[model samples]
Target: MNHKVCVQLVVAAWITGVPAQIGVTYQIFCQNFCGSNKLNHIFCDSSTLLEIACGDTYQKEISLLVNTFFFVVIPFLLILISYFRIIATILKLPSTSGKSKAFFTCSSHLMVVCLFYGSVTIVYVRSKSSHSAKSNKVFALLYTIVSPVLNPMIYIA
Candidate 1:
């Protein structure tokens, strides 16, 4: 298939999975959180919600880790594999300019992926504590703001 067709198929698959992801996330996180309504983090993301949870969180943490492994870690691994293949292909090109050009085509994409996923893993995947809340916000900001802004700058450049 052509690149466009392949992209469309990926998009279709992603669209179908989004609801399932959202559903599982909502089931895991949407709960009667007992604490000060005032949250410590800038956003009311899972990390913040988890900080305020009242009961024993062993079960919830396990579920979140499993869900994260499936949704985040798996996809990140796939992306890394794809980049490895791309890098191999680029390395095989004989012309110096050809290799650089090929690498440049996807370099920005890889950077953006690393920026977002690396920050996300730090913010959500790690076991959180009150002390870590401050650091989580920094990573969350990178995930939400800095990573996305790079997309336009890098891709549109």
Candidate 2:
């Protein structure tokens, strides 16, 4: 029970923190990007924000690298390490009567973790190799907007 509560709190912190970071970054970027021109998408797009923030050549490259690292790479590594530790602990457990039940619970959690992390990694990990503005926008939409919506669906399932 204590472990569950702690885990829930940690997850809550992460969920809250990521978006807050994004929001702060967005505001900082938007101050530069949000004038005169109307954004095509309803939600404030990160790429659009970046395009606006990157008015100068130096600023553009720096903003791109920073956004990619923070929004994509860091989260991917964190999720990977988390899941690895989870699975390792599960695997090392001794067999018992409740083992099946424990496995079932872990399976559901593993599924959600994989789905969320996989989508995020698929999108953001690609950014490290290829530097396409369009791809970044598409992945940003996936990781930021679409994945959050799907996360709840995974939990519900």
Indicate which candidate wins on lDDT.
Answer: 1
lDDT of 1 by residue, 30-148 (tens): 66677587888878776567667777767767766776777779889999999999999899999999998778878988989998988887776776543376787788899899998
> What clash count does candidate 2 reach?
0
**lDDT to native, each model:** 0.79, 0.60
Per-residue error for 122 in candidate 2, Å, reads 6.4
> Cα miss at 42, model 2 (Å)?
4.8
Q: Which window of ten consecutive residues has the lowest lDDT sum in model 2?
A: 120-129
RMSD to the true structure for each prediction, in A, is 2.7, 5.5
Which residue pairs in model 2 clash with each other?
none
Q: 22 in model 1: Cα distance from truth in Å?
A: 4.2
Where in model 2 is the C-alpha error above 4 Å? 1-36, 40-42, 52-54, 94-141
User: Could you give candidate 2's per-residue lDDT for residues 1-157 as a string of tens digits?
Assistant: 5999999989987996688677556656555544557654445644455445535534544555566577557776887687778767767778864567566666766665565566555543443346555555565566566767766665665
Judged by TM-score, which candidate is best? 1
